[model samples]
Target: MNKRLNSVMARVAAAGWLIAAMLSAETVTARAEAVVAPADGYGFSVGAPMTWMSRAEADGELDAAARTGASWLRVFIDWSRVEPMPGAYNWGYVDHWINGALARGIRVLGLIGYSPDWARAPGVYFTGPPTDPAVFASFVTTVVQRYGDRVANWEIWNEPNLPLFWGYLGDRAAGYTELLKAAYPAVKAVQPGSTVIAGGLSPAFAPDAPPTFVAEMYDRGAKGFFDAMAMHPYVFPHGLEADTLNGWSDVERVRQLMVANGDGDKKIWMTEMGAPTSAPTAEGVSQQEQAKQILDGLRRAAQTPYSGPAFIFSIRDSDTANQDNREDNFGALVTTDWQPKLAASALAR
Candidate 1:
């Protein structure tokens, strides 16, 4: 009887030690995450599209971004503009803009998308998905081959779930997944070190809406294609803190989706996020409030373990591009002339 009791006590003690070890491991992991927290990791999207910016203007914007503590610049590669004809290509504009930004010490996130006229179906917008995945893949190969050494990060397309961007492709995850599959390999073949980031996804409302588009991508085995995922948690009008259209917690939801698909290891970058100060909507906030929300959102993102660099949209206001356009107004951080906004002062390195 005593031998039996001794054996049971030994088993219990072994179980207790295992529990203690697990607790210790969890604590260690938590500490690691805390250490890596990007509390002050700030970046911004220059409002001007890369396609139209001249070399001088591009340099000024890059300088401004570097001065403002921005380490990363997100700009559209615009396949339509770069490759206007079937085989003819105009590498002049992009080459100048990219090289200029890099010279300013700002890392560029080359957003490659928008179908060239020859690559698109009839009556569809230029932003629509390409008619043939091969055409898009070829464009990807060319851009990466040209700038692969200087640019390490490449975001494939932008907001594919939105109607404005992908109305031609529809919300068919398989369609976008196919594009990703094609483009990912093309990038890898040219620049093996290049990081292929899934396009920044927009926050969509319904349950089976935009967010599901990501789940669909995973379902189609897109996990193996890219290095990281991207998102645009605009959460505008609603204070950056408020969970508008459920966007406030989009980072969390996206993480959960990644975990469920066995992709919990991947990082989610906020490629675009900001609240507008003017052109009031039902949920609009004042200019001062916009500044406050920007800080709060950055703090919140920093605390998240899986969150990567958060790029606030628009380093400067776009007064010339339809001043009343709310999106144009989203850039209240500075005037079109580069005058500082309240939010500009709040952005510390």
Candidate 2:
């Protein structure tokens, strides 16, 4: 249930940085027990792709993700894939994915989101939010129950703070709090001990940018909504604004709301965070620069309060132009295929 961010010196996979996690950094010994995961202790989780794991050479890729350091494994379990048809369920994908990670001695962080067509759209959760709360609830309950004992943490959604995710103008869709309202109890009732984490949030440059996600959730009465929380607090190189300075980029600005809602005791997790190895666009940070960005934030995550483990967004280059569905190259100092970048070696500490 509890993991010690026991390993300190994580190596840089290659030349760039997969910047994430947040801390003001003092000293980090190469492979030293992470100063971030709370002396109370939480282990670092290595992120990997489902498609990659299905490959014959997946073992080598998994090994590379853990090359620097990681105690748990992070994977996205999409609703769209898990239950492609309404009422019909499939555990084949999640089972295989988690089993593979476990075989490597890694724990699992299962993310749940992106409702299936049967669940409908323009409504309750992710891009195509569920129309019926009960339908979504059934999905969550089934998945959590199946992996209840195996996986301790389950995230509800991804990048839930934007118009594309939680923010919807048509009929004021995505009703942020409602998604949790339905999911929290459903997931917990099946696995009372499992941690129902908030959907990962996106931290933009302008402190008070578009959604004001935290404020909206709190206003909608999001008190006691989750166990450990999460954020995507990704700021541009060397940029920190008040709203973007919670503990990490994803959970940005939400900590205060948690406190306001009388849930300060709950911890914060960075489900998605990383600096790309290369700029998918001309304005973005380079892949090499991303490696450094990751080190900066990760040090902070290990050292700060309300801070937990900061998992890099990706293990390899996913797409080009991270923005606009571009690849953004948010690896932890290496290319997606295990090519070593500058920061990769640095992070490998």
- Candidate number with greatest lDDT: 1
RMSD (Cα, Å) of model 1: 18.5
Across 1-349, the per-residue lDDT of candidate 2 in tens digits comes to 1111211112232222333211213212322332234333223333335633443334444555555556656777878877889767776657776786777677788888777776776444446567776777788888887888789788887766655664352422136578888999998788878888885776554433323666666677666777877776565544343323343533534666677778888888766656554534433565445654555567666666777666766665554434543343555534544454444454453
lDDT of 1 by residue, 79-196 (tens): 8887899878888877776776777777788889888778889888877888789889998999888888888889998888777787555655777899999999999999888789
- Local distance difference test values of all predictions, in order: 0.70, 0.59
Model 2's TM-score against the true structure: 0.77
> Each candidate's TM vs. the true structure?
0.83, 0.77
Task: Mark the regions of model 2 whose C-alpha exceeds 4 Å error after superposition.
Answer: 1-53, 122-126, 166-174, 205-211, 237-252, 319-328
Q: Distance (Å) between predicted and true CA of 325, model 2?
A: 6.9
TM-score, candidate 1, is 0.83
Worst 10 residues of 2 by lDDT: 1-10
lDDT of 2 at 166: 43
